[model samples]
Target chain A: MKQARDSAPAERALFYTPESVAIDYERDLGDPGSYPHTRGTRPPNTRRETEGHDFLVRELSGEGPPSRSNEQFHYLLEHGATGLDVIGDTPTQCFMDPDHPYAQHAVGNQGVSICRGSDFVALYEGIPLDRVSCDHSLPGGFAAAGLFLAAETHGHLPELLRGSAILPPLFAEDTGYSSNLPIELHMRLATDSIEFCSERMPKFHAFVEDTYYISDGSVGIVDEMALGFVELREVVRRLVARGLDVDLFAPRIALLVNCRMDFFAEIAKIRASRRIYARMMRDEFGAKDPRSLAINVAAHTSGATMTSRQIGNNIARGAIQSVALYLAGVRAMEISAFDEAIRTPSREAHIVGLGTQHVVQLESGIADVSDPLGGSWYVESLTDEIETKITDRIAEIEALGDVVELAENGYFRAIFTEAMVDRSREVVDGTRPVVGVNINEIPPERDTLLRDLLENRIAPCYDRIEEIAAWRASRDMGPVVTALDNLERLCRDGSNIMPGIVEAMRSEASMGESIGVLRECYGRPYDPMGCVERPR
Target chain B: MTPTTRLRVLITVLGLDQHEAGALAVSRLLRDGGAEVIYAGRFQLPETIATTAIDEDVDVVGISAHSWEVLHYAEELALRLGQADPPIPIVVGGSVITAADQVEILSKGIDATVLPTAPEEEIIATFYRLAEARRPRL
Candidate 1:
């Protein structure tokens, strides 16, 4: 007989009853779409009736060239996917062009290689911008500039665009997402996009604080939500200080949360997040609009929990995690494919991942009602517990001084490193039961089928060096140089950099050139990696 | 052949693959296992990693890969490290690493590979064996 575990991953009590769980329905657990929305942000059945489905099924699809990613977007749309979650390759995310020395081997390994507005043009060639909701996973200012330019090229006004842009967090350097850029400049670029979009693009989410990477570092559920709120508060403070009304942009701000494998804990964390955001927005910021008080949550399944061993087990894990998201009332979600642990999803694996969402939406009956586990003693108790813990954790983080200072001083890295080591130790010692990794016993020789699957796995392969070179040569240098010079002027003068970025894109300046100019103005090397020097 | 010296190892992630949880954890694991770990951190190029390994006089180098960049950079990294006076062995590991990836890495002159699922004892033992093979015989 095996010994039973009694605590959740967050170290909270596993079981609850009315005696342990105290709830005042009128105050703590109000009706759906009500103030301080503990139940949900939307009215019951809003997803099924108002929204296209119970929830928008958006699978993250991006790999190789823009043309290939465009094909993937159409494929997902044709196969019941309601939205597109586009991600960029690592080099693009780091503001490196294909020809950079550091970007040589990593041109288009994981996600799509997008360097300029032209790449976005190829990415969304035939997909109408207004008809679909596309979420871009890229750095803030660059994503906005590229999309705006693409919309202009396609004759679609920016105001009519339906999508969201990721606002890179202050700790982007610590996370290694964009280490080549200085942190202050990164935040300025993020704010520039938010300020630009607040006046325009009402339909687009101007600021999406993605906590997926943070949580994936093995940070506990409580700290994940807490850190997310702290980052949100910081961004909100920056925008408000810029004299922008909270209502002007608050309604469009959102969070990209991570749905980990903890069934009840994940659900409770998300539900608690809604209540926290509602109270924080109303009480702290003095926001007047009801829409501004409610926080929009889009979730991505935790890729950290997926394992390379027993590859098929990930499908089961993904399905169970998706249930947690639906129960928590996520507006949109992307489930990780079964083979995501080994490589980027193959076409079949991507479709199977999409199929998982469809089955849950149509067959599971779990999405039929809103917050179906609302009044359950265990769930309600857990929600209250997580809510209080997250609030306390936020204060603890704030006590460490400014979030940017903490990030620059290596505070986030230290915590993340400790958390990661502790988690790895647990798995190594069998305290954490990862089925294929530590708990179950299987010899390598007997797992030949999985080996075969791994052997046939396809990674995106592309050589964008010559293509980008050709693109550069084809464009006239006169406007490009002028645009880059103007961008530098704006950077030095402390003006909003979005218009300059937009103008640079209009002149067909590549992302590397524009960012290189900004880098130079900031008194840093043109390439943070020290690979490329500015041309005379 | 039980030579007595604390083994020195260089741990790093090549290129823009920034998933550092595994790499950081392995650094701690090696340190705990009595090895002197020189953690090179993230975004390391092949030439830089090779120079650091030789500069630090490490017995073996470990590349913690969470993406397919390991496959693309493996040959070049092997070539760079091979030019040292006494070539340093390279070991690779990650959650994304599969048996096929291990075979591919081995063919590129990498000495060994460890999966995240490997027990701590197995991981430590593999690194020690690789380090021992690279040691100078008296």
Candidate 2:
């Protein structure tokens, strides 16, 4: 009975043993802050002294218009939040202004909506661009240029601005739906940002591969690892082909992967990711900088795993995921609030989410030892297994020619569709029982807790007609037209479009106007009101 | 009744919420369960969602959400569908909506509400029940 119970097989392996896994300490596990860095990218507790802090507790935030987000940012900063992760709304991300018909209902619904550089200035008002690090979660492209223009508006030097502009995959949503712009156009914008950041903003990360989006597509952990690396490699290839060295920008790029409820598997996934990145940067890409070898990882707690049945239990889920992120030695992390399953997290929920991190950091002592489980037989063995799986998956993707081509053709999308269906079936069929959902099922009376929570939720506020009227009436038309013409010329010539974008932003050109210039240059139809019909 | 006739279901997202995992999963599940599925994609307005349902002649419209936007948009969608020439059955599902909220949305003309963890049988039954109920009007 003991043997049967102990030998139960996991998803990858049938059984576990040091000899069976063939673990060699020198070859497989290296010291902390050393090559391979399986133990961690740094020794335990050194990050606090060297970086003046451990991981930055940056909460993913933003909603309503720029002024609203600015106030929210101040509130968060006043409440112990160390950094900013601005979430741009759909219209801002798709390069549409609030005035667009398609954007009317969506403005300020998910995140802060901005139409030009001035919106960004207002969004970060009074927050010193030079002092505080920020991350802008912009979906489309050219957000880096937008941020640069915003900083410049405040008389901040381009070189002194810090933080990142996360280039979400070319596609807006992760459901394999059609993107606002085609793949090539998205690449052009991304490459433009990379080149501009490499030259002007040395401290800024022009792009970060967000595997959180990959996981949102319902792909498994191994697939997330494989696709994230492929994305970074593709970006590097594009940059290097443009005559930029690998080390010049690779150090600035980072990875923001998902942290699922699978504690040990998630730990192994993150650990293996670092090792793989180190090897690829050093050997394949011929990177010399040690900073380039060290992959900066940020983890977003899994929203998919949150149970709506008993939402209160989600705090425990977040705590478990936070531990996984911290144990894996992530540079930054965000925990989804318990109420995330029911609505936009309330202020109390945000406090609780941040408090959970504090508990793990202060009381739990989980962050005291870097990669505390690094040498454990099980963790080490699982790390090796996950690394092999990730490499194998990438090899399969490489056989399909360029990853971008494959992605455009729906190769990765098909995988996620299938994985999502299968996982849902497992849950529905009770083969994989979620605690508060499938088992221990209990429906609260009247659902007063959730109802009260909903009462506290504020609907996003935006008046498109009025706001657009005021904005258009204020900006000087001559400079806007000249800047847009210059942008079109740069786009037509295939020159880096970042400088032109910054110029256009400086002239108070709205996002739609900037995108319109590019569309005209490409001879593509300009319709901010257009929707990409979901292809069957 | 035609022997090969299949129930056509339309799944979509509304407002600014971009969570597609639940929507995509439901699409696949319904597809595998022998229903023809049409995904309208995410960030669509309530008007667009209603127009698509009418254009596609879908038997049931399923809206997915992951934020409070769903509460407002789903209600609007439900009202729109109710006002259609031949009102279509509407089902709203997601992780964030509570039972009381579901009741409120249902009262606003949504035909059914499915939780993220709802079983396949319950989902299928709700769709068929609502679709069948709307057949006489059609």
Candidate 3:
């Protein structure tokens, strides 16, 4: 059988030698947690005191309404999940209410639908806010506002809150997966959350630069790192320009990267990413705090690599990717479920996915040491090569223009589209050997059982339109209107919109209504889909 | 269909599902196969898709349904497109699409369903065949 020996995406050298590496330990491999944290973020013995596991096994779990997803949260916790990663449904992520005309079909389809602060309250009904680390993967000011209001309702102060919020990326509008708010207004709203969290949420990560979107959009590993670092730098520049110290918000900044099938390259890319980030922070921003120099890297197994043809093969893929992530010394990890390529994972598949992490962490003993593959000749050489490639790629990306200009001019989209086409062509031409897809073949009828298992695992649909209507009827319109008016004024006056958003949520305003005000202030349609007109 | 007369196809994604790789890939494949591709991008409503197809006078409309939104909106989209004078043929494809989903969508009047693992040649051929079938009715 013919096989491609080159590393994917970047097509780096397949083999390396000591002469090729020539890595100086003192210069390249500093002690863990020291300046230029290339080996790992923390020392080997610096595991979390509470849990024996070295890394936090945070599984992505959210579907249906807040109440339903809340059950999954508790289920995951009971099953030994160290943290919670909550995802919002399409409607909620886009800041549209379930009642919106364009949002009806997608309500509660992909993730939990949280249309209001109360929904967040219900989502974490009995879960203690301060005790568990949550990744609020929803991007926007509304998600942060809802979460903040929920924490307050549960008697937790902003300072006591734990977890992270995914700030909206500049390429969000270009990708079409997130809100369609203009890039400038979107960044403004995101900056508001960063500012709010930097001041109050001491233990919370204000911005998690998720390169998973870029990689899953068919971008190469080198480009993914380049784009991620570029976006992170732009965010840092904006925050610093606001008169905030580099050390203040930089410590809270983190990355969520994708773990693809190229095991060694993925590991090298992650190691290089840490080194690049540390250098950028210390050299570029002049950060003094050690915490600001170290970056927290959370990885998710690439969902794009999961094949719909041979569903069970994805389990092995996830396990192998988990091992790569562990060897690379990721702080937190989430394995993609085998059924993810088909639909939202079933409970059985979700548990198995969680078990994959546990098996690797506890059973395999790979986590006993930090950066176990740190000094290997091949890994070190590849890491150096990747580091150089990513630096050059970043320079090329910077030369194109700023993040916002690249986003508006469709530069990222063009590259991603080209990559996607090339990938498909590779599969078609047999250059890429996807086991069940292009290489080893299987008849469709033979996989009926697997198909049944994945297809039958459909998330139950909740009538959120009626639920929102009833909740709206139960709330007072007076406070809601006042809060929305205040939020609009804050948007117009160039003030942080987080406080106003929190006020609206506290007043029981829906996310759509709150975002509608921001959209109107920014001169866009009240509805991102242009389905509804702004009220005069 | 004559070789000189290029087949026009509109590629789009409906609802809030933002995974556009499949849609974009199909657009590229169709364009490479000598079809006049009208890429509609994302965040499109079913009504808007039908209007775009009719307005562009495309023979076939390809939807990249990467989520269950297609299951919910397929009937409506098919109905809207069916109301056209020469109803457009709709093809849905995505990684998330299952054989059962293909059956369900086909039952809803979708003209064809292509799996993500389908060969580029087969996919291009399917779209061209759908376009050829629609031309005679036109």
Candidate 4:
């Protein structure tokens, strides 16, 4: 009933008949696996039919020490998870060692501590890298280097590795993640990793742009898809200019989309994003390969949609979003735990999220038919409308001169803030029904267990300071210094920083050190304790 | 506008915690409640925040902490603001903080600790209460 901010408000359509909307099956609703893939990417009635083979059930699992995360990985695997969405701790994401002054408090608090190549080795000690698809949230190519070094040490070839890097251009800059370096340097490092992956780890999806961090419920669903396309275009244009084939990277450019509680809108957004991406690749990028035309989507159940008032309601939200993604033919899916609004998901909450996906896939026969809502006139109309709105927004961004210039000038921030303020006001004023917040009012109760979890066991990795110190002391510093020197040199030479970072990782240089070398090369001050300043 | 309408509140994130949602929400609530709200945005050092508070001549400062670094940053902000003739009231909130953290933050002379999920009315009430309490001292 509600509309996204940018899109036209919900039309007062009492009934939808065939006369209301006309759809040309060939042009608008083409068959799956064909050009301008509107219905689905893969063919209908195949692995996607009845059997849930097409979609990888990825658990967004990780927390505390690498060993603890290792346990989570195994736990998910044991529970029939197809892929592992490895979440790096705040320190790791920020490229800080556990011993760094800023990192001492946050290590393993948000996710798993991954400051060194050894951490990756420990994270996947028994898990075969080649067999399982592992997605990481680490930016600035730190995870790529760490994984490379770990693979080499564990006698696994880089070519056989498969995974995705959540290296969105401004993930750290946009989100409050600690980005020690500026955005330009971060982009360079990310591109370097992508370039390396293109040549070496061909199966690995080098970039996953998650607009959720910036989405923040501020913009419409179409705005989210449009912004993602704008970013994809920018990145692909840069990569194409750098002499890389579009087909090489386009297939691996996965989108991590947030499926909020808007059921039909969320479903439409997913379908629209796929069609738009396909056409953009084929028409603009000259992508001849069908694989390049297709898009891999990892739908994450919206964390912003979860409420602290009625925590259990989040389970229903997660299930609904998962079903939407499944029906939309998303390649990978992650459901946020019910307790995420309060703290890092507890073990029970994590299991519930994983179980939600499993139940939706097995019990709900919705995925048995390809594009279950394909022939529905309402869905088809919504899909067309969403695609048009998103394309218009992308064009709007392009009209604003250089995308980089716009990014630097607080354009996106302004857009996000205005929309967010408007959304929040609507929620407060009862215009937007946010379930527990504005409607279905529940008298608040002091959940002591929730408080206890927050006060005590929420952040499960506090004793890592000593272990990190010990790790630092045991590792030889000479080779680490040498590797850093090489990294700095490579960075200064405007060369790909991947090789040097992998070499540094091999020498046991912590993630922070590798990033520090790049920071130095970029002529930026090295402040591991410093936070990235918000755009003015 | 009356003095109450002119009352200023600065919302900021402390330490390396980059979560801006809490700070932004608080800023919006305080502004909508008729107080002038100055958002310090993210990744601000304690000194920067304290100096900004002094420079802006704000009535109160709210720090959104979403990591363990809040413990470190809140204490640092207090120490910086304490040097002033009239130290500003600082409120901390986020999912990462706890009752123990609230106690520690208050012990450092922060004015209040509002949970992120606290009602908007409660948030607005806290702002006015702290602003009024600090008026005489200022």
Candidate 5:
């Protein structure tokens, strides 16, 4: 039989790897402390603080609605996690308070439920405000809606307090976000957030999640990802022109990313981002402050791959993801736990998650050298190739029109469908090994870890859920009602919703009410403006 | 017959879940073995899924999940299908679904719980096995 041709090189799949992507493993170009930022994001200083737990520890939410996610907050602090990344429940992140009807089903699925000053204060009970570094992945829902919810809790946005508040408006609208507000109107509010954050909070990172490039079902070319950054760069320049100190805000503008476990592909993404952002910051935006040019990033493990079967397998997966992100040159990082695929990570799961980082950061010696793979022939070549692919995809999207147009046209949807089709085939075949999932025949070892949560009959965090639910029920309804009305007015009138959300929170509005108001204001999901076609 | 008039088959993976690779491959194998596929993207809810299958009038449903919580959910979903007098064939796949989960699943009235390591040919063979097991018995 004649041999068939190998199709990898032709499809440009060769560049999507770790061996080709992870560079410079052998040489020590610089110590961990070097300024050019190669030997890990920081220097090799064995600060005792970074030793005991994760170099960066984020707290899980707490037991009360009016209560804060303080249980884990205090734990992270007492346990020596220097920086804290706290997640607000969906209600708060969406600028809603707990009592809103929209929030009934989603109170504490992801994190803590914070509605007002008291909740924020309580959440931060033991943790000092100034010392903790927080990343609030709140989207404004087509307007700068969730910013204030974060502000009341964190004492002020970090970027703004540090004189670098550059809150970029949410642009990747394909995450099922279709607002009743006009695109131009949304643009105004986003820029408003940039302006507001620039002046008020120091060290704040007004940003957009970058997982779309690597994760979202929308699989655009590498160019589309780069172009998204480019468009964002333009948004920054537009702000600079409007007299927001471009240097301060733009520099503090960080990229929220998901480091997919495709190890080298992720490494290449970071290098591309830095090189791309550096050029954009220095040359395009003319950002002179070293802070402005610095490309800071916060990464999560790919949510897509976080699975439910053989839950313990996610630990190794999370570790691989962390190693990938750190390799990609992120200064600070957070890791999801092995149990992440199951539900909100248990306290023990969170600790092991933090421990995973410690193992990688301290024990594995990964952070001992700078972009260790930077100079490698395979890595550099792949990095360049990834940049090319990303750039091409961005242009393709642009040619089709802006992100909104691509979204409206389902261009993004089509790409993801195709990607899914391809991946589903891999799973059906034996091409990819998911360990205990697919290839490995063994069951979890007896002490695989988390004896109680893994082996025993621990109940679902249902008690935690019920606690927040009851708190929402007990709160005064009058003020929350009024807050929702004001927020609705803001949403309807094309006004920036961030301030209104904060105002509502101050009134003890629960997250649900706040989010409900906006959902009503934005109306239901999406009404295809031009499809007009009859249903099948 | 209207192209949509035929019974539909929904194959999806839900939650912070994404691992279309194996399922994608399995989907093609099933297609070759003669099954219509309604491939919903990741993070589909149970209600949404049930509604899709009902609306599509699918005779067989195959769902994939990666995380432990989702696998447990998948099992519950599969078990629930038997209650629908005209039961739909349910098959589950993903990295997490294992030989043990498969056995527990069979007892729940699920036809099959496909392992990620199984060959495509085995998936086809199993697909037919389940289909035969589910043959109309008026």
Candidate 6:
């Protein structure tokens, strides 16, 4: 670790001595890719030169069947997008068959509707697995399978295979999906997933702790929404102690926290998050591996921060989030388009969004220097101070009985409600200007069709699944049930449920049975007794 | 002479994934409506619907479903009510039936398809109207 300038103030502050500025860089600033891993986490000098071209934004889930997602992937890649983010159909996430009664609701909400291993093979099709990073980020029924296949296809199964696939947490608390499932069951399933990955896909990460959620059914917020990443640390700790080897899992367990409008705060979040995670993993859990402490941001340009009112104002919002990304040490970004609130991303919007990142990477000369905010007294001080705040916050959650209990009680949800109210009041009262919602006298309506088209397009997948249902009825049910039976046995004994699940998947067991096995293990649904008095 | 108006609400659990989060979130919406909600949990049967609505004598029976296959149970529940000496007004919600699907559901005597992940206020307001429209028929 080298120090250029630690005592000088590049920027002055009004609120408090720039907290990020106060960091003891002499003590913490490590090399770009080393342990204590403060400066940067990825391989040294891996920052790609910002492309002059942009990702050709294309709508997923219509016209072409999802089995052919790679066509769309290649098209977008050829056109502009540097990476791919997949949205699988309902059956896969819920662990049901396309024909299952549970999946008939929303088959292909946004991305491709994945079914089994065959669907996964087709989804990736020709996309090179090792070249560009793919974010089939969220994990559910078939998510891990998608990753395993991708890893294997590349023929690079290094003994310790690790990467990110967004995974299920004990949902239903707020995703509006997991609310009905028993929290314990969901927790157990998540735990089982972590256990499974630790043994085989050692180089791969199992959980994303994504807080993007079905939030506001509207806009997005920062990492605070991600099950309180601070508290989620305990989830990792508990799993580590369960004999799965904490040090090995630490390198793989990364967070995909959100970056909202509070720019400096977002910066502090990234810097402070590193220190917080490092100390927690090292101090609390006694984790020796340094990578486990890294905080990776699956940076989504704020959805809530965007304005449908002005329509064009969202571009500015996207830029603000993009700059925040650089300051925040963002690992990967899913920059939102200009009209995100009006509708989904259009070609112009996506290009503009990706272009924003390109501009940052190329013109700003920010990535050339590691830890660009390394010596800012404000950034450093805030890094250390916020490290305390976030750590204390996480400790508060742990006091309530780890991740499962705290989530069941809506601890973070309650805090979020209060924060939203405070933030919303500022927007409404003119203390803060939204440019579209409260500030603009007349809100724009250019993209109502986009919303309607999305609503309208999702209908047919429901009707099509009827055929799958009939076909599934005749596939031998014995293997499906038996695989699930093994899953139950393994889960009850605290053995990793992944192998059993993989076996079931091989046997062509429907996703529903996978979830059923999980529910059986965790016990059928539990309803919380107290109402957390917060939220709109 | 006085006239009373009822609220019409369409609530459903959207998507083929039987996430009970909708059931509870919908329940909050229903409770806010001040109407006796015919609460149906995951994996509901046709009879569960008929019996609960009959027992509660509610103004609106809001059903939650995550998939289309199961929404038929909701429709059958609605149909069972309609085939009776008098039919009850049924509204839908969840990812199961979007606004586009609302028309198909309405053809079966359903009043609405509650949009997926509607907030409590919107869900409640929709029900207030749905209950009013169905009250006369019931």
Q: Top lDDT: which candidate number?
A: 3
lDDT of 3 by residue, A426-448 (tens): 77778778898888878877865
The DockQ of predicted model 3 stands at: 0.70
Question: Interface RMSD for every prediction, one decimal?
Answer: 1.8, 3.5, 1.8, 2.9, 6.7, 7.3
Give the range of the ten consecutive residues with the poorest summed lDDT in model 5 chain A.
A1-10
Candidate 5 CAPRI classification by DockQ: acceptable
lDDT of 5 by residue, B52-112 (tens): 7667656677776644445445555765665555666787766555556677667766677
List TM-score per model, in order: 0.95, 0.90, 0.95, 0.92, 0.72, 0.74
Chain A TM-score for candidate 2 is: 0.92
Q: Rate residue A319 of model 5 by lDDT.
A: 86
What DockQ score does model 5 reach against the true complex? Answer: 0.23
Candidate 3 lDDT at A103 equals: 80
Candidate ranking under lDDT, highest first, comes to 3, 1, 4, 2, 6, 5
* Candidate 1 wrong stretches, greater than 4 Å: A1-14, A45-54, A448-451, A457-462, B1-4, B136-138
lDDT of 4 at A508: 81
What C-alpha lDDT do the candidate models reach, one value each? 0.81, 0.75, 0.82, 0.76, 0.55, 0.56
- DockQ of predictions, in order shown: 0.68, 0.48, 0.70, 0.43, 0.23, 0.20
lDDT tens digits, residue span B36-104, model 3: 999998788888999898888888999997878888889989999888877888898888787778899
| Total clashing pairs in model 6 | 87
**TM-score of the second chain for every model:** 0.92, 0.89, 0.93, 0.88, 0.77, 0.69
- How well does model 4 score by local distance difference test? 0.76
Looking at candidate 2, what is the lDDT of residue A394? 80
lDDT of 5 by residue, A188-294 (tens): 55665665565555455555434543444334225335545745755675677676677767655766566655677677666665556655666767777766655
Q: Write the per-residue lDDT of candidate 1 for residues A1-536, one digit (tens) a residue.
A: 00111125545566767897778887777887787787778876544532433467888878888998999999899988888989888888888787777777777767888887788888888888877888998766888777777788888888888889877667677653855676678788888888888776778887898888677857778877787788789889988998889898998988889987779888888888889998899999999999998888889998878887777788899999988888888889999877777777667778878888878877777776778889988888888888988898889889989888887788887877887888887777888788878878577666554446565644545457778878877888888888888888888888898899989888888888888998888788887776666543
What is candidate 6's CAPRI-style docking category based on DockQ? incorrect
Candidate 4 lDDT over residue span A346-389, tens digit each: 77777788788878888877667778888777777778778888
For candidate 3, what is the lDDT?
0.82
Question: Which pairs of residues clash in candidate 2, taking residues 3 or more apart in a chain or in different chains?
Answer: A341-B96, A342-B96
